[model samples]
Structures are given as C-alpha cells and as structure tokens.
Target: MEPVLLAAVVLFAGAYAFINGFHDVSNSVATSVRTRALTPTVAVVLASVFNLTGALLSTALALVLADRFIQLPAGTPGLGILIAGLLAACGWGLWTWWRRMPSSSTHALVGGIVGSGAASTLVGGPNIAESYQVLLQQIVLPLLLSPVIAFVLAYLLVFPTTWLMRYSSPRRGDAGNRIAQSVFTSAFSLGHGMQDGQRTMAVIVLALVAAGFSGTTGIPLWVQIFSGVALAAGSLFGGWRISRTLGSRLVRIDPLRGMSATAVSSSMLFLGAVWLQIPLSSTQTMTSAIVGAGANQRFSTVRFIPLREILVTWLVTAPVTALLGGILFLAISPLL
Candidate 1:
C-alpha cells in the first residue's frame, strides 16, 4: 500500500472512531443525567474528561484485540473490504440512532469485519482460520454473558441495599445516596472510558496496520490521543435520546438503584478490559443492569416493549451490517 493510501485509511478509521465515541457516549452518563444527579452539560463534560483519562490508563487489551481482529493475512483483505466494513458499521449505527434504539456498535463493527473478511477471502483465496478460538472465547462469550451478568448483579445488588435502607428517613437517605450516586457515576464514567473508548483506538490501530502504516499491535501515540480526544468530545455533546430511554423509560432510578447499576456495569467493564481482555459494550452492560435493577424493584418495572426493541436491534445489528458489508465490499472490489 502506498503511503498516501495508508494515510487516507488511517484518517477514515479515525473518523469511524469519532463516530463510535459520539454515538456511544450516552451509555455512560445517561442514567446520572436523567436522575438529575448531573446536568446534561455537566454530565457530558465530566464523562468526556474521564473517558479520555481512562483511555490513557489502558492500551494492552485494546492492542491485543486489534491484532486479533483487524490485521488479516497479507493480501487476504483489500481496501474494498475495509471500506465496506466501516461503512456498514456506520450505516447500521446511524439506523439505530435514528430510531433511538440502543444497539451495539461493537457488534456492528465485528459483523462488518467478519462479513468483509469472509467475502474477501472467498474471492481472493486466503488460508485464514474460520473458527478462531479467540473469536469465540473473547468476543462471543463476553457479548453473550456480560449483559446477563450485569442484569443479575444489578437486580440482586439493588434490592438488598434498598431493603436495608428502608427504615432510614427518605430525605436523608436520598441526599446521602445522591452524593454516593455521583461518586459511582464518576467511577462509571472512568470505567466507560477505560473499556469503551479503547475499542475505537483498537479499530484505528487495526486500520493503520492493515494499510501497512503501522506494525501489528503497535498503535501510535498520536492515534491514541486523537481517538481519546474525539471520544471525549463526543461524550461532551451527549446523546439525550438514548439517555431518556435508558434512564427514565427503563425504570425509575432512585439513587440506590442507580448506584447499584453503575457499580455492576463498571465492575463488569473493568474485568472485561483488564482480565478477560474483551471489548464488551458498556451500553449493553448498563442496560442489563438497569433492567436487573428494575426487576429487583418489581417485575413490572421492566418495560417489555422497549426491551424488545433493544433486543431486536441487537439481533439485527450483526447480520444486517454483515450483509451491507459484504455487498459494499463486492461493489467496491472492482475499483480496489
């Protein structure tokens, strides 16, 4: 690949990362903002800043995931595949955003990559492993289990805490819990930065490596800083639509419930980033936590309609994006 082409690919990847950041920022701060724990502007600013700080805190996991997923065998993938994958991911993301549905950008990107890779390999012929263990163990497992774990954890954690505090004065408890909620919200923002922000960095790094601008697993400092800043800026802008859905429509979040959900999400996210080394979606985990917390309050608190929409979005994100990716790859293959 020529230097100019490589640079162009890197730039495209950066833009994709920025989109990811802006699109997903609401996942971290929506609850806090909706509950009046933070004003929208303040929530966005704080979340964005912490997110940037968190990105600087972790690089190893992102690098590993990037190497595993993005850098295909030399000559196995071409520019067409890359463009298709990105466009498909972006397109699916925008579709979900338009409907105010909470979908997984991570899944969309993964689907795009898989679809494009499969298509490119079928056409160009590469001996890449179709059934890599990392894909199953790291990507699939986390995606399948993280939400369940978050839901159960939040459900279990919230009720007991609330029960214990039942005898306390409501006003005092609310005030104290509000302060605690703020702390937990900040922690959630930090964890969100650590986990979710790294995903964009990983994607950009993968693009650079794919275009031969960077060696495998070696993400540039500028790339990291740029991705971090872009994501933070996006968070600062915030996504109020999703925030309303997650924070209010899902359940009425008292400070205790909010704190419980945030804690569970942060814990799951950090474990995935540091131990499991998987790039799980913060939005999914948090949503599950919210559901769990709501169920703990009352089974009826979990709204089935909105949840069904979310599930449908999740189910469709991968396949639809994959199909789009495959089609786009084919269409652009002639030019590339």
Candidate 2:
C-alpha cells in the first residue's frame, strides 16, 4: 500500500512537470516564433533540448526547495499532502493553459505546497508557519518584484538596442535581429530549465523523503534525469494557444524587441536561479519583457484587455491554488 501510494505521488509530480512544460515553456519561444526568428517546430525543439540541458546542469535551487520549504511527515499522510498539492498545481496549470493564459507554474506549486502544509496540521503534520514564511520571503516577494523589474529592464534595453541598430540597413538589421532572437531564446529556455526544473525535482525529493528512502535532500542523478525528461517532453509538445496569446495578443513584437525581451528574461532567470538560488516564473518574466519592450514602441500597442486578464489571473493564482490545495488535501486524506 505504501509503495503504491509513493508511486502515485511520483506520478503526480511528473504530471505537474508536464503541465508546467505545456503551460510555461511556451513563453520562452513565443516571441521568437512570432518574430519569425524560428519556426514553431524549430523553436519548440530548441527549447526542449536546452531545457533538458539546463535541468541536468544544476540542483542548487532544488536544494533550497527540499531543505527550506516545508517539513513533510513520514508515511502516507505526507504523501497525501504532496498528492493534493500536485493535483492543485496541475489543475491550475491546465485551466490557465486552456484559457490561453500564461500563468506562473512556480507560484502555483508554491501555493499548492503552502496550502497542503496548512492542511497537514490537522493530521499532526509540522507547523504551517515555516511554509508560510518561505512562501512570502522567497516566492511571493520575488513574484511581485521580478515582473516589474523585467518590464523596466526590457523597456530600457530596447532603447540601446534600437539605437545600436539605427545605423544599419533594414535588411541587415532584420537578419541580425533574427539571429539574436534565436540565441537569446535558447538561453532563456536553458534558464527556464534551471528555474522550473528544480521545482518538480524538489517535489520528487520531498516525496522520497516522505517515503523514508532518503534521509537528506540530496538529489539523485536518476531523479534529475526523470524530472528533466518529463519537462523536456512537455516542451516538445508545446502550448500553441498560450504562445499565440504571448506572441500576438499582448503586443505587436518585432524582431529587435523580441530579441531584447528574450535577452532580459534569460538574464533574469539565470540571476534568480544561479546566483540567488531562487525560483522565478519564466512566463511572468517573458511576458513582462514583451510588454516592456512593446511599450517602448507605443503604449497603445499594448492591449489592455488581455493584459488586464493576465494580471488578474496572476494576482489570484497563489490564493486560488492555496484554497484548492487545501480542499484537495482534505478531500483525499482519508483515502490515503
């Protein structure tokens, strides 16, 4: 019974990673595809390859998630919390993806954990305060600030990029811009793997800990490969609906601005994952960068209705997932 339940937890974690890829990886390539820098197929392939590379390269952020997030109890009850949290995150990812909305998988996962942690208290689980503290200090604060910074940095970056290209012929500039977009989108996908890959890895590690197979948060190589492959597979599948929203509905993006957005977002993702050991939303950073770069051309070019809808969803994602996680945990605890 215990082994079967552990397998179920692993299965759900894989599902979250796949849903994450379907929903979030598209952000890395949306601008590149829209700008004709890469065809849809090429972009998705590049993203999948680099995302796997990035996932395999590091476990720094994954360590933070395992050690600092929440304390998972030993046995089936702990597995139940993880199952509920994963389901909540997966459900939110699918819902937002279906709506063609680009939402944060990172936040959804954190909210799910926080929600499940709170619910676990009823079953003599660890205090929820620790999870709450980390959520605010680590996840929520960064979530609020990173998007604004991505927007401003991208907005400023467009000035210099445009200025540098001003002297070049349109044909020459377009060619250079395409190359730049491709390179930056690859880098962004690599960074996305680093940021989001750790998320699923952390959840898997937590599951292992709960099952009493491991005494520490050390990530096994097999676990890393499994998480990487799941995410990469999802990336291969891609999310064209949300990609269309990001590529066309939010702003009219040109090759130069698209390159600038990718550059800014990729740099931010690297900074957050490698240096800060923090998780960031590739979707949030990329979307904000697109808007930022587009606003530089003309604010009117930024569509408010769609942007408003995205913002509302972003604002509600954590809270709504938290509630959903709690409900799911409560509902499933008895069976587990």
Off by over 4 Å in 2: 122-126
Candidate 2 Cα deviation (angstroms), residue 329: 0.7
Per-residue lDDT over 1-336 for candidate 2, one digit per residue giving the tens place of the 0 to 100 score: 678878998899889888888787779889998999999889999999999999999999998978877777778887888888899999999999999999998888878877887887776655457467777888789988999999999999998998899999988998999999999999999999998888888888888898988745589998899889989999999778898899999999999999999999999999999999987889999999999999898555899999999999999998889899999988887776
Q: Pick the candidate with the highest lDDT.
A: 2
TM-score of model number 2: 0.97
lDDT (0 to 1) per candidate:
0.74, 0.88
lDDT per residue for candidate 1 within 31-59, as digits (tens), equals 77766777777777788888898887888
Every model's TM-score: 0.92, 0.97
Error of 1 at 87 (Å): 1.5
Worst 10 residues of 1 by lDDT: 70-79
